[model samples]
Target: MLFGAIQALQIITFEPLLLQCNLWLLAGIALFYLLESGERTNALRRILRVGVVGWMFGLVLAAVQILPTLELIPRAVRGAGFDFDTISSWSMHPIDLVNVVVPHLFGDPYTLDRADYWGESFHRGREGYLVSFFLGAVALLLSILSFLSPRRNLQRTLLGLTLLSLFMAAGEFNPFYRGLSEHVPGISLGRYPSKYFLAGALALAVMVSLGLEVLLIHEARGSRARRGVLAVAFSGLICAALGLGMHAYFQSRPHNLEAWIESMADPKRAAAKNFPVVASQLNQSLRASGIFLGLSSFLVLVSRFWEHPRMSPVLLVSVLAGELIPANLRVVPLMSDRDVEFVPEVITYLTRRGPNEIYRIVQLDSPLQTFSGIWAPNRSWAWRIHFTRMSGQPMYGIMSGLQYAVFYSVDNLNTRDSDELYGRAFRLQGADGLNFLGRLNSRVLLTTSEIPYPGVRVMAVLPTNTDRKLKVYWLEQMSPRAYFVSGVESVHSHKEALERLSQPDFPADRMVILENSGVDTKPGDEGAGNARVLSYQDRRVLCEVDAQKPGYLVLLDSFYPGWQAYVDGKEAQILRANYAFRAVEVPAGKHRVEFSYRPLFFYAGLALSCMGLLFGIVSIFWSGGPNGFKAVLIYLKSRHKKLKAKNGLLA
Candidate 1:
């Protein structure tokens, strides 16, 4: 809003340079503070200093978000065999959300939706709207009462502080979007790391501090206001004491702590994978509660400084809400996943496949409607039956030459017995569904999985002779199976699909057996003990004499227990690479690649950058921040009035 309002204002005046409005704002705010606080400081210099400091702070957060430290990632593991940085660019939506709400709440929550909302009256998904409304109205009402009260002395100061305390505590408004005139100066010190909604709470905190500071100054300046100051201060103390007591009784962070118990109690599966349904519901509740924590804690600190009798009663409410953002949000990210596990793959496959093969798929799914529906006509195929939702004809309305692949099912493939959710992606076309022709060229046919057709024909399924050969992608392309461009050099011990490479002729290149070949066991524990033996079995490499290609090749002397092979850079499936040792038919040219596992630094960097942002946010509201905001304000106000008056006559 600050930006938008300024832009609108500038349009009337027709400013010279458009984007550099921050300079203008700096000048304006400095002047406003000067006028409001009464000339007690240097206008220009102080204005520039505060502006630079605040902007620099924001810049630092931006840099950290873009930096490479994986601070953004919630979890990092060594040797996990997964990389997040195979692609460029860190996802910013999650980090941005926390950037707005964290400092106030002191915790970050998880959300899959990518958005950065900054508004005084904004709510994502849902908000305790009624709760927020009541708090805000009461706060505004208290502030009005104080503002209307006469007497700028210590007595008035106490009332003023009470009002400010109420404003900060009530928090249904987002203050970060405002200009320098919105809230206290250092209130948003570390604001960038938090979500925007917390800005409302932060703004209110500034008011609390300002009111208290004014009261302190008023009492200090001669007069018999000292006892009144102590009374107000003492009253604030009581409020603080009561507030803490209430917090202890009412504030309990939303936690999935029970997840641990449930996982252990479920004797059926591992906690790493299978989870009880209760954990999911708990996660949602935690997300909702987390939003409140940010608002509550902020209220607590502000109350300690500004305890007006009226404000004291409300302190309990604000403290509780502030605590909500931190408590409930801390666990939110644990559960948010914006992209479904299967969507990215569907997009990739649609982007890569060819026309004819897709046509064949259409024939297989909706045999009656396919132009060449001779093959797989009955639609009684296992894959089709499990995948398609409809029973008959309408599935082929648009799949004449282009196959309308309805479902991409994993359940139909290897885990048919497991009853997983994947079998529904691609199946036979149903009677009710209208098929839309996908825009894909014939090149996609080259990237088929176990079905391998069009340009990719499966030679034979030799499950006995293990040999998995293929380049490994740094980031696993989440899909039902591996996709290769017809250079069929994959032999997974786990998959029973016929192997057929671009070059069907087996390369007679020799393969080498590399293994640590060791056994770990205690003395005399060789029986059924923790000791195991590794008996070397004969392992060999055969190829169509790729003495023509440039890679190491030698027949393996023996297969050690944990031996595996890769034709190029890709790592083979466990025990599967235990044998793609059959052959490698590379284009007769020099190729460079390695088999060691590498980490995904790109994603890691994104994670770290976000984490830094998180830290920056928490640091902003460290309570009793760097002082002298009044000085900065005094300077700006003087300059602003003079500049406006001088320019006002001409306008």
Candidate 2:
């Protein structure tokens, strides 16, 4: 139930929070359950059964999404694992614990100019760690109180989970995370260890609830109330001291805010213009911290001096609301009308070009980077900008409903051949590079700068809502989506094929490489057969070919598993040609060739899902009545008797 609730809430954004929370909950439950079970084997078995059922329920519920993901994940870059250095980039620091208790200690990093300036210098653009895990001082105090509750085992288990999450969140700052990533199977899938903070937050929430219940007990006498007051007072004093110390440290720094602002007036130093704004926000945070501490102290005094039970709960609730509501408001600001204003002209223009036209558009400048200002920022201002710029480019193509040559996603399956093609088109200069783009069926090129390619004609100069200009060029000789080649060349390796492709006069349209050494074909047979594309679709292609003799028909499509080819209604072997495309041999005379994508794993998963659904329905019907248990026993006994009779007959 907890996992389901978390998953449903997290559907708004697919982050690792739910996964972290689920891991913590399951581990804590299993550990506590095991310890409590002791020598009782039946108890242990019941716990294991319940756990298994819950896990299987989760799996079955998510099978539709999981099945397709399993098929595609192995083909992605994340399948191998991320580099340690990259994964550690978002790690938390030991000092960042202050922020967990005191939230917005430096200021809101998601805003345009609110981040800790000094922290960014040493933390590689990260303003501060633990900013995302802030639960306020009130929650912190409650969590501490949970330790003294009667439910010792549950509290201890939660505390252990909290510590484990904190250690993992520290990433490279601690050794445990590194060791776990190396030894564990799915642990390496997480790029940001700080995401584990969600588990810590979940544990703390439970602890806070337990603690609050203890405090709210009406029967609590004078001493118990006094102790609670003392705890709150101590927490407030500590927070006050921390805030004052932080302010002193910032004041002692040699960098002068006035001078920094003056320096940014120079056009060359415009990048530092936001520094002053950040400094002001930091000062504001300092003031806010002092106010929070003062309020906490006042609440502690009220709880101690006053005896009314109703008043204590009311004051505590008011104080918590006062602290959290502003924080929430600051983090999530109202959206402006301009936020939704995108480049409609570009979308309209692309839509006007018939959707069935099987050609791709290549954007010279990554749209994500170019349109970073439009996307929501992250916890760290610098990282927010970087992430938005890197990931936003694909949105342009998606919004316009236009096929783009370059795409990026969590599961990016960029093969070596595809990478080479992309690099040659973008990095290489002159007509050779432009010709490669044409061969890749990129009919349109969108760039922020001019290119001196003769084959491309300037179509339009479109203006974006952000006041940026985009130059659109149309390639005169874009290749077909599915083409054929009559001649075949035997290449020993990808390197050899690449070398052959680099030649000035290499006939990309006429000749293609056959990787298998067994398939002997002469490179000189360039015009042995003729081929034309008859129909083209997203997953299926049809072509008509006339071969003078035995020749190969090559299609300019990435050769991946599950793609099958047929020639004249007979199944044919699909070879990986030109290092990354598909090819098939055809007999003499006219013949129809077809290519279709049909993954067997997907079908198998669908069948299994159907079976599971049927079984669930039958179980529900069979277990509906009050005598369901007796019915089940009888059914099992009958099955056992039938099996015994069958065995006896066989004997």
Candidate 3:
């Protein structure tokens, strides 16, 4: 369990918390059942105990990552407020529920040259859920049959879980979901509620297996076979009618189809060129659905006449494969291998820099616009613009050993600061905007469109012949990474510091904003100081500073917690300056200044994990075999009692 948790944290991109939440819920359910059973079965109790220990072990194993993440989340944008409309953007459509049986109702757009119909919505007009909720036609029928089996308790539990998951996946459509998001601590943190489909899928699988077993082992084989045949026949008729209705619906919506095809071809006019191709794919999907349902019905009918023990199971498996495999094939081609080596000419131009020179580059693509455009693409060119915004150019900076002024991550610790700086620099266009970038040592600006600014010269026009060319600009008069400011002004709040930064003659190079309260400094003390960076790394910076009198040395790095400053190996206070940058006070004289990241919580969590591991190992050796687990429990109980008694005495 510990190993699985660590791997999930590292690999899973979509929903990192889904697996943990499901496991926790399952453990709680199991414990509840064990307590309610009244038998107190040793086997059941042992299983529950093992589950609890495994969960604790996993939590301990991931404590280093978990601790910092918890501290950072509450301060993040998403965690600070819960937006219902934003969360509902990824909700599953009610009609998409039919995908559980027939997945290719709309042809797979990813694999096919073009889908019969397409929308710029989530999953390209398909369901937004991670995995299709398809349980196969036979599995669905069997799951319905499982309710009639003798295992009523198990069936009820599985059904309850499935219903609960589906309700959660509905997002804004379900009232219960809104309540859950409001009350549950971590539930609202999940961006996509459709991720709950994972729990539904698991429950469906278990129920399907139980249903299949029951159908294959009934005492009255003939009666059961007859019932199966009737059920399949009725379902087949319903599916055939639905398929025909869909065909008619598509025929009536030809204008929508033509518009979609035209958008793909020209992106400007509503004149369809590949109408025949689109029509052909739609017809193929309709025919395929009809044929699969017919074949499944025939197989079930044949089983009624045959009394062989294995015939029903074999036929069911064959029907399931036939129904599901082809639907899956149409979508498999969408996942093309990424060519990591395909660097564009514009990127190549920016990678060329002097060994000793350090500067930051700001990409002109607005993150706010990009996030908004992701959901609402009403214009023909919106798709292309959004794609460019979501590209990996910012990540390329790291690979090319260049510093990008803007950086984002799933757990963006410096989101508020970064957003403020980005908004001031790129979003607001003027001399003040230019100065904002200059203060952060941004020497280059990359843009998709022409942005004219003073002191910025066009460095290169990448792929000059192409319509979608990347323009690179060389910015002049940017500040150095580390600089000495002789004068300082104490600001009570971040708002005041930001307002000061916008002043035309703000003396950004001469003075720094010290956010600490009641700090006294002489305005006329213009000390002679020089600071030169000796070494620079991602989390650590070393500099040599010589100040004739007391002054402040400001570093143009995002002011984040856990970064500690040291002057000649002695610790010094790090103050927030210019709203997002770091500053440290230096006494008169030449000395080495170093800034290093040392997160206290991570180390504390690591130490606790180590101690817990040692205790587990010691308990195993002391108690011997499976009894070791019980011995550990006993020890914990005794410790709890002692702590309670000591608390009482203190009280």
State the C-alpha lDDT per candidate: 0.29, 0.64, 0.64
Model 1: what TM-score? Answer: 0.26
TM-score of each: 0.26, 0.80, 0.79
lDDT of 3: 0.64
For each of the candidates, the C-alpha root-mean-square deviation to the true structure, in angstroms, is: 24.0, 7.4, 9.0
Query: Candidate 1 at 171: error in angstroms?
Result: 17
**For each candidate, how many residue pairs have backbone atoms clashing (under 3 Å)?**
91, 1, 0
True-vs-predicted CA distance for residue 40, candidate 1, Å: 9.4
Candidate 3 matches the true fold with a TM-score of 0.79
Report the lDDT tens digits of candidate 1 across residue range 1-651. Answer: 233233334332322222223343334345556655655467656666755655554443344233322222222122121122211011122222332322322111111111111111123221122112112322222232223222334234344433333333222232422332134332322121122223334334434444434343433444444444444444444544453443343335323433443433323222222233334333433343343432333343354356463463366445545544444444333322321112222233334542212122221232222211123322222223212212211231331223322323221221221111112223213210111111111122211123321223332221111121111111111111111111122333222211211112322112211122121211111111010112222232212212233323222111122334444454433221112221122333333222222234444544654664565545444323444445556667989999999899979
Error of 2 at 497 (Å): 4.2
Comparing candidate 1 with candidate 2, which one achieves the higher TM-score? 2
Q: For residues 1-651, could you state the per-residue lDDT of candidate 2 as single tens digits?
A: 334333433422334435655666777987777777766787778767766765565455455455655666676565566777766767876756766765554445554433223344324454444444567766666676665566778889989989888888888899777777888766776577777777888888899776666555524545765576576667777777777676666567525643553442333324534555555655556656666666756665555456765575576667777777787676554444334345455556666753346778777765334223443334343443333222224542354466766544433346546656666566657787777777667788876668776888887776542334567788887666655566777888877876666555767767777886486665546567777788877788999988887777777778877789999889999988766678888887889999998877666666655665565556655774755755877888999999999999999
In candidate 3, position 566 carries an lDDT of 98
1 or 3, greater by lDDT: 3
lDDT of 1 at 403: 30
